[model samples]
Target chain A: MRNQLPLIIVFATGLLVIVTFFIPHEPFGSLEQRFLVWYSIVAGFTMLLGLDSLVRYHLIKIRDRRSGWGYSLVLLSGLFVTLILGFYSWARYQSPFKLGSPFMYLYSYVIIPLQATMFALLAFFIASAAYRAFRARTTAATLLLVSAVLVMLGRVPLGGWLWQKIVSLIDLLPGTNLSGLKGLEVFARISDWIMDVPQTAAKRGIYIGIVLGGIAMSLRIILGIERSYTSGS
Target chain B: MIVNIIGTWIAAGLTIAILSFLYKDNPLYKFAEHLYVGVSAGFGVIYVWAFDLKPMLIDRFIENQGVERWILLVPAVLGLLMLSRWFGKIGYLSRLPLAFTVGIGAGLGITASIQGFLLPQIQATLLPLTTINNIILVVGVITTILYFYFSRDFKGPFKYLLELGIIFIMVSFGASFGYTVMARISLLIGRIFFLLSDWLRII
Candidate 1:
């Protein structure tokens, strides 16, 4: 009974939502909105769960005197301070002395730079990973190496000069011609074609199957038939 | 004038602190990293409550007295139920919220699949192949798809053909990467220009 109930619920709700998309009526139009509201509520509650986990984990680390407990303390203290300030600010509404006033300063000076730094780390990681992957030991690797070098060159001002030289040389061939305008136009056209055609087509096929599967899954949940998310059954 | 000067100084100081990690890990970077995470999380929660829940839930339920105010009860119950996870015996109650979340997520995924993925892809592929450039695209598509076909055993000539397909894909990917790198480099250059010209007023 436990298993059957949830499964039925999921299939039913999933099917309704999918059908709702096509119907576009008073209730159907509101279906997505209702789901969003539900999502917001659930997300808010889940955040408390996340906070509990964070606090518990750090507390354990501190108790155990784990490596970097000092950092953890700093983290917990910051979290508490921020939470107090946030709630205080919200309660006071437009109060000039609200704790949340310092938040913008903290974000501008601290958070943005950290995010930028993390992204910057990607460049070094990519270089290292590419170096290992692009070894020219086989036919495939050799092709990769050549393409990488060409693309790297083609993107820069130096690449433009090189392309011009190559185009002029090709033009010199008997009864054959390649103008700079023609070359540039052809390159741009090819690039756009590559992005729009095969890439888009491949992504589309994967997406369709995913949608159908999701519908089936959601239907299983909303109808109270997919109670696997609950305990016991 | 004072605010502008202070802002410039803060920017320069933070930039230096972040850049210091590129040379080696330091206490300054660690401090900034922790402070960043803490402040960001705090601000994010506030924004969520103010922008999302305030107008959507609290205002509707309390101030406006909307008919759908009763809908707030459903989530409010679920939210209270979730707190039951803190207790050993009632922890199972938390599953109610989890199930609802998964269901909604699944519905969204189903909708997004049709809109975001399938239609655009089919349209893209079925586009005109009459032009010379389009013919190249058609060849690239067919060959690349063949290259990915894993079920059939590929012999010598077929292997060679697949290799050619792989080369085309690699070239395309490399070009994309090169473009991305150029963008990042340009951004870095822009920042340096700002520091020199606007901040210092010495360009």
Candidate 2:
């Protein structure tokens, strides 16, 4: 009963939604929005489950004097403090002190910087990963390397200037008009075309597959066929 | 004067404390991190209550007495059903709510596909192709699409055309990357200026 029920629901729901798209009936159009709100409520509650697990894990670690007990303490303490401040301020609906509160300061200065720094780390990581991948070992790799180098160069002003020079030299021959707005327009057109066509098509194909897969998965879940995410598992 | 001065000082101190993590983790960073999370959560809850729930549910459905009052019960019931997860014996009952959510999401996704993907793409393809720029665009689109066509292998001249399409794409991507990097650099510069000028009042 536990296993089969969810799968049945999932499949039924998935099929309904798929059909709903073509139907364009009154309730069908609103079906998605209704689901979104329900999902949000469920998600909000699931966050509490996460918090419970986090607290339990940290408390156990702290009790056992684990290696990173201190860090765990920091995480828990942060979680609780935030929860308290958030709840209090939300319930009261008053400024939790003056206009320029400590909370505001922490948000703008500390949190923002931390978030930005984490994102900044991606640039360095990408560079390192690209270095490893872009080795000129084979024909395909060489092509990749050449493309990578050109793209890297084309990004900079110096690289653009060099490209312009090469383009102008090529243009000296008959039939090539590579100067001013015509050149810029051609470049922009080429770039836009690449993005709109290949990138968009590939992305769309992947997205379609993902959507279909999701439908299948959702069907499985709703029909009580997939009990994996449930507690019984 | 007192509040402004104190606020600025608090901001400066917190900024330094957070930035100290760039050097390495410390007690100061931990303090700031905890405080930030707590306050952010508090504020977020308030925002949701005021902006989302108040207008949508309370004012419109309950107090303002809209026709959608009965419809509101569906979500409320679902929300209650989610709490079933907390119980051990009847936890499977949560699937009812989960099913409703999945159904709705699937419906929405299929609908959005038409507007977000199909319409925009068709509009793009319908552009005039007589001009040099338009011709380049048309060629680029066809060639790039062919580059991605893995249904069959590109032999002979087809391979060369694919190569040219790839180069154009790469150059475009490079230009985008350069712009993005400059934006990040500018942001970093701005932050530095904030520290030097507003926080320190040195300027």
Candidate 3:
């Protein structure tokens, strides 16, 4: 009954939503919105399950005196403190995310800086990888390298200045008539063309395939062929 | 004024701590990382509660009247039922809410894919191939799509098309990587600016 009931609910809910997509009538349209709202609420509550798992994991580490348990303690302390502050703000101001709230302060100062600097660290790694790994070994590799270089250069002001300098040097030649041409912005134009045409094609093709695959997977889920969600401890 | 100054200093310290990760996996970076995870998770919890539950469920339940008010009990019950995971024997009951969400997700996914992505992309791809750019775009898209079509091995001409498709894909990847690097560099620049100007008052 437990299994079958859920499957039935899945089929019913899935079918209703799918059917209502085609029939955007009075009740069906509003019903879909209501269902979405309900789903959002339910999803919000589901987040507690994740929080439980996180807290439990940290607690287990602390209990076991595991390696990096100190860090886990730090993590838990940060979490609990933030949560306490948030709830306090909620109680006091009726909004946890209110401007000038302590929660907002934490978010702005601690979270924003930590997140930004964390991602910024990747820039060094990417540059290092580009230096070591990016070689023009073959036709495909050469294309990739050239495209990357063009994009990297063209995205900034340096590419334009370099292009202009080169154009000026060429115009210094005996027979060159580069006066009629736009010199500085040529690199950017080429980069834009590459992004707009070939890049768009590649992305569009991949997106189409992904969307088609998603539809198939969604169908499988709705039909109960995909049952992995039912299996857990 | 004092609070803001204190906040800026704290932010600067955290920024430097995170940037210290570039040096090595030291204690400072580890502290920052763990704290970041905890604070982010806590923030997420508060965000979901404030944005989703409070406004959508609790507020609506309170503000509405008659049948509308009571209708919210359905989701509230389902949400409570999800807590059945904590119990051993009745843990399977949690599948109901999971199934409900999954079904809704699947239904939404299918419709959204068709309506939002698939049709629009296909329509956009069907462009008039008058210019060189258009031709390249049309051919690039076709060859890229054909490259993924693995039903049978192409003998002669289609193989070259597949190779061409790969070239386009590689270029796309390269362009994407370049853009990502630019973004990261910009972020790094922002951090430097913050350190120099906001923290040290140099710039």
Candidate 4:
């Protein structure tokens, strides 16, 4: 009965949302918003559930005295301290980041740098990878590598400085105008052409395929062919 | 002034600690990583509770004291059921919310995917083929779509079309990679600026 009830609710609510999109009127009009509200409410609880699971996993590690159990203690302490400070700060000052609040103190001092640094790590790795992978071994690879280099150079401030100097050097040797109608904005113009023509077309094709795939997948789930959402059953 | 300085020091120290992973993974990086995860999750919990649970659920139901709002108790109960995975016996009950979420997600996806992705993309491709750019755009789109078609074998002319599709796809990927490099460099620049300006006071 429990299982049946949920599936029924799913079927009904699913139909309701799909139907409401076409007919935005009356009880159904506000219904789309109401459904969205309900979805978010459920999502908030899921986040709480996630936190609970995180705490429980750490608790188990500490209890079993696993490797780096001391780190678990730090984890638990940080979690509780942050939670308390956050709610306390929110309740008192109505801002998670109110001045003189512990939440603000921890968030600003700790989280921001850690998050930024984590992503910053990617920059070094990507540069190294690009060096190896972008070697011009074949015609296609050469084209790709050249296009990438052009776009990269065109994007940065130094590219503009270098381009102007080259144009002037060339003009001294031979050329009439040195550059033509698209003189000043030459680098940006190339960048725009690359993006607008080939890139947009390719991206659009990919988008169509993705949308079609999504539609098929959604249909599969709706018809209960995709039952992987169930935990074990 | 003192507090801000101290905060900047702490942030700079942590940033350096994380960057140390580039040389070798060590205890400092692990400690910073663990602390970041725990604190962020904790912040999320409090934020959700204060902004979502307290205002949307608790106050609306209890403080307002309305009989009509009592219906919200349904989702409140369902949310609790979602927590039942912690228990061994009744863990299966969580499947209910999972099913509900999946179904609604699928339904919403069906409508929006067509509206947002399919229709607009087709509309975008319907441009006036007057300029060289327009011709390139149209040809590139058609050839690329043909590359993704799976049901048929590419024989004569289709083979060349597929070949062109591959070229377009490669250039597209190259452009994407270039932009990603730009984004990553921007992030690195941010950290460098912070270290120099805030920590060393050398901007």
Among all candidates shown, the one with the greatest lDDT: 3
TM-score, candidate 3, is 0.97
Per-candidate chain B TM: 0.80, 0.79, 0.96, 0.90
Off by over 4 Å in 2: A15-32, A91-106, A120-233, B1-61, B64-67, B132-176
Candidate 1, true inter-chain contacts retained:
0.34
Query: Model 1's chain B TM-score?
Result: 0.80
lDDT for each residue of candidate 3 in B1-203, tens digit (9 for 90 to 100): 99999999999999999998888999999999999999999999999998999999988988999999999999998998898898889888889988999999899889877988888888988888788988888898888888888888987887999998998899998888888899999999999999999999998
- After superposition, candidate 3 runs with Cα above 4 Å error: A179-183
Full ranking by DockQ: 3, 4, 1, 2
DockQ score, prediction 4: 0.67
* Model 2 C-alpha lDDT per residue in residues B17-105, reported as the tens digit of each score: 66676667788877766655544444455445555555555555666345567777666676567667678787778776666666555
How much does candidate 2 score in TM-score? 0.68
lDDT of model 1 at residue B118?
Answer: 51
The top-ranked prediction according to DockQ is 3
What are the models' TM-scores? Answer: 0.77, 0.68, 0.97, 0.92
Q: What range of 10 consecutive residues in model 1 chain A has the weakest lDDT sum?
A: A198-207
lDDT of 1 at A94: 57
DockQ for model 3 equals 0.81
Please give, for residues A1-233, the per-residue lDDT of candidate 2 as tens digits. Answer: 76566556566666666666667678776765555555565555545555566677878999999976776677666556655654565455455433345445445544565555434434544556557656667555555555445434544455656667777888899997767632453433443454454434334434444555555665555455655654441
Model 4 chain A: worst 10 consecutive residues (lDDT sum): A174-183
Q: Which number leads on TM-score?
A: 3
